[model samples]
Target: MTQTAAQAGRPRTRRAPRRLPYLVRQLGTLVVTLFAITVVIFGLTAIAGDPARDILGQYATDAQVTAFQQIHGLDKPVVVRYLDWLGGLFRGDLGISYQSNGPVWDVISPRLGPSVVLVLFSWLLTVVVAVPIGLYSGVRLRGRRDASLTFLTLIVAAFPEFVLGLILAIVLGIWLAWLPVDSTAVSAGGLFDSPTAYVLPGITIALGTVPYIIRLMRANAREVASETYVRAAVLRGVTEPSLSLRHILPNAAPPVVTALGLQFAGLIGGVVVAETLFGFPGMGQLLAQSAASRDAPVVEALALMIGALFVIANLAADAIVVYVTPKLRDAVR
Candidate 1:
């Protein structure tokens, strides 16, 4: 009759408690954020007046415009149209494009792959380059080398994506003749059709994102380096690499990870500019076309997608921070 037999007789065993409240709160926030994004995107386009009028132009007859409106259901009440649009979203209908006479998702789907590849490559490259530099700069603190790099990061970060893209295009593409001037990979064939063509756009995206990540990491490292544990390790004659890699970095990474997650949203803006500048047919390019034509549905679909991605990035960061930081994990649980 032992404890083992007693336990074996039970139908269930206790399981570890999940951070249910935290998860619920995050999900609630996500829904709110998505709703807000949809509203803003939809409202802004509506505010801009009818896309049918924009498409037809000023010289078009009133009859023609009204016919266009009726055909697209734009003649319905604004509130009714919005409600219908939302309903269609649940059925995977992203709405038809006013300009292209095609599904908005269909228009964006082809470009998504290249954008994913471009952004991911830049993101990885940013971390690879930023981390080591930030680590060294962080440890060096007040030294000349650190100050110089910090100043340089500031200057580079100040430059907009298009400006940097132009500079890189001029230097690497025009002068050196080393790579293609523009990302015409898809037009030429496929993304891998020309490795050289992809490099410039990737570089364009990385430059804008890298500086902030580096600066954030540097700040976090400096703060972590001052922690009591780090000071004690230093006094114990711990090797610098061991102290940095083992103690300081592990403690410092949570904040840097959070900052990195925020940069994903910033990257979307950069993508818009860089993609247009480099002629990369990503969401940015599509966004430009949609905006120019006042294609409300297309714009709404893209805006919502980007907004969801931004929210997801934040959720991921929260999850990562909670997982990696012992204090947060205990608190949340």
Candidate 2:
């Protein structure tokens, strides 16, 4: 009887070992996120004060506004309109931009690549520069090196993006004469053709993000350095760089990963001010124009896209953490 029970339990334990892919878990999150997004979109549209009148003029008659509403199907019930929009979304149709007088994709797609390129470079720069600096600072906590880095980071973090953009523009663009000062000089059509155009904006955005990553990494590294395994590794003739790179980094990575993901999402939306300051033609500028013009379709589409990107970035980070961290995988299970 004991032998039979052990055999049965072995199979059960083996069956329980199969882990669900992160993508599957994220699919459920996406569904709930989309539902919430749809509700917000519907509510915003319902309470919106006359997109037609805003687009056309205040002097326009009620008939003109009513006609515009009918044309856009805005006169329909909120649920019906939301369903129609949702269906269109599924069919790869985000509907026309009321402001741009063009397809939503036509307006948004061209700008997406530039934003991606800029943010990707910024993220890369942050990781490359921040990780080492953070590690060194944490390792040399009582030294002048750490104190100086912390002071610089605090100063940088205190400045707003717009202020940073203007300062960089004046210092680098004018004083140093290295890059373009205005966005008009930067060609969004060929992002790589003018890498100089991205430098200012990327750095400006990175200023805000790098500090957080550095601080998080420093704190995590400090804690990690005190851990029993790390202390043992240090005492076992392991080099500081080796222990930090192999043990500390991998262990400290989860928070850094999460911070970078959230930062990327924030950059997507936060780029608006910097984009405006620099005159860079990206989704941020597009969304600003859409909002100013009361273009509900474009605004809604942009909002939804931004939300999707945020959710996807976070999900990707979670998935990465689960894949790389055995502890996280077990927790999920």
Best by TM-score: 1
TM-score of 1: 0.85
- After the best TM-score superposition of candidate 1, give how far the Cα of residue 75 lies from its true spot, in angstroms: 0.6
Flag regions of model 2 displaced more than 4 Å: 1-23, 59-63, 223-255
Q: What is the number of residue pairs that collide in model 1?
A: 0
lDDT of all the models against the reference? 0.83, 0.81
- Residue-level lDDT of model 1, residues 99-183, one tens digit each, is 8888888899988888877788777778888877888788766878788898999999999888999999999999999988868
Q: Candidate 2's C-alpha lDDT? A: 0.81
Cα deviation of 32 in candidate 2 (Å)?
A: 0.7
Error of 1 at 286 (Å): 0.6
Q: How close to the true structure is residue 76 of candidate 1, measured as C-alpha lDDT?
A: 94
Report the poorest 10 consecutive residues by lDDT, candidate 2.
11-20
Q: Write the per-residue lDDT of candidate 2 for residues 1-333, one digit (tens) a residue.
A: 999988978855345567676677689888899779877975786687668888879899999989988988878887798889989999999988776678888878877877788778778888887887787677657677778888889999999888999999999999999988776555644677777888888888787788988988898888888899999998899997798899888887778877777677667666777777888887777778878878888888888887788777777766776776788777776
